[model samples]
Target: MTPAIPLVLLGLLDAAFSGFRAYAGSDARIRKQRFATRAGLRGLAVGAALLLAPTLTAALLLVTGDQARTYNTLAAGGLGYLLPLTVYATAVLLSLAAYFALPFRASTLAVVVGLGPLTLLRPLAIAAACLGAVLNGGGGSALLVGTIAGAAVLCVEPTVHRRWYHHVQ
Candidate 1:
């Protein structure tokens, strides 16, 4: 398994959770509970996938025994390598909090507070993808997948927020 696959998967997981959070927080009572449950399940799945990824990748490497000389494969695929995922998760959490705390509807402050970190991290997502590609022996496909995943986050998050805002308002 190339390194890009894991990174892209991680990116997609991050975006999925982020989008869920954005969409789930708008409702009240039973709807909120259902949304939260679904979102939590998604998060758990993502976490499990991330935890398994390194071991799976290592197993594949052992099977293939392809010497892709770049960096330490184990280290590259390890938990520490998921810093980008963690950062993205943090940004999503912060955005969700900000979205709740700040007033919606024509409020630039709310949007800025909610999206600032995500915007800042957009470039970092690309950088992480590039790094993952490099570490995985120049599989540009992984980078492309990661980039697309990040773009999905960028697009979906705001739309989720806006939709929820409109619904709530």
Candidate 2:
């Protein structure tokens, strides 16, 4: 089993990146630059909180021995660990595609077709990834799967946003 420290560090990085993305994508801003700086800082704080909180909680749970069995069962195993990562990646990819193929009014049929697979396969993919990780063994494999998934998600965001803005206007 991988040491808890490294896993905690990885989780922290992931949280940070996710928080940054979330903040950058908020709808309240008119000028991207103006809000970007503030959002970035906010994201950093939120990410740190997320990463630290979970790690601390898990550590405490481990010490207390009163840990939630169900969660432990799911997260302790390799497959369980990978499932959520895979699903998250699949969902983000699908959302990106959906956003890019926007102007739903114009491409209603295409949008439906594109989103169809995502809607159906996202959950299954995540589940399978998690299962694969658990069955295969945890460690770097889980992180790799998650990184690849996150990258795929990132790739589509810009295109989707542009299309969405165009459609809105």
Top candidate by TM-score: 1
Clashing pairs in 2: 78-133, 78-134, 79-130, 79-134, 82-130, 83-130, 87-126
Q: Write the per-residue lDDT of candidate 2 for residues 26-123, one digit (tens) a residue.
A: 56657676555544455445445544544554455446554555234425543455446545555555655656676766456544565545545544
Give the CA lDDT, 0 to 100, for residue 159 in model 2: 34
Compute the lDDT of residue 61 as modeled in candidate 1. Answer: 53
- CA lDDT of every candidate: 0.53, 0.47
TM-score: model 2 vs. ground truth: 0.38
TM-score of each: 0.42, 0.38
Per-residue lDDT of 15 in model 1: 50
Clashing pairs in 1: none
Q: Which residue runs of candidate 1 sit more than 4 Å off their true CA positions?
A: 1-31, 46-55, 66-71, 77-80, 97-108, 111-113, 116-169
Clashes of each: 0, 7
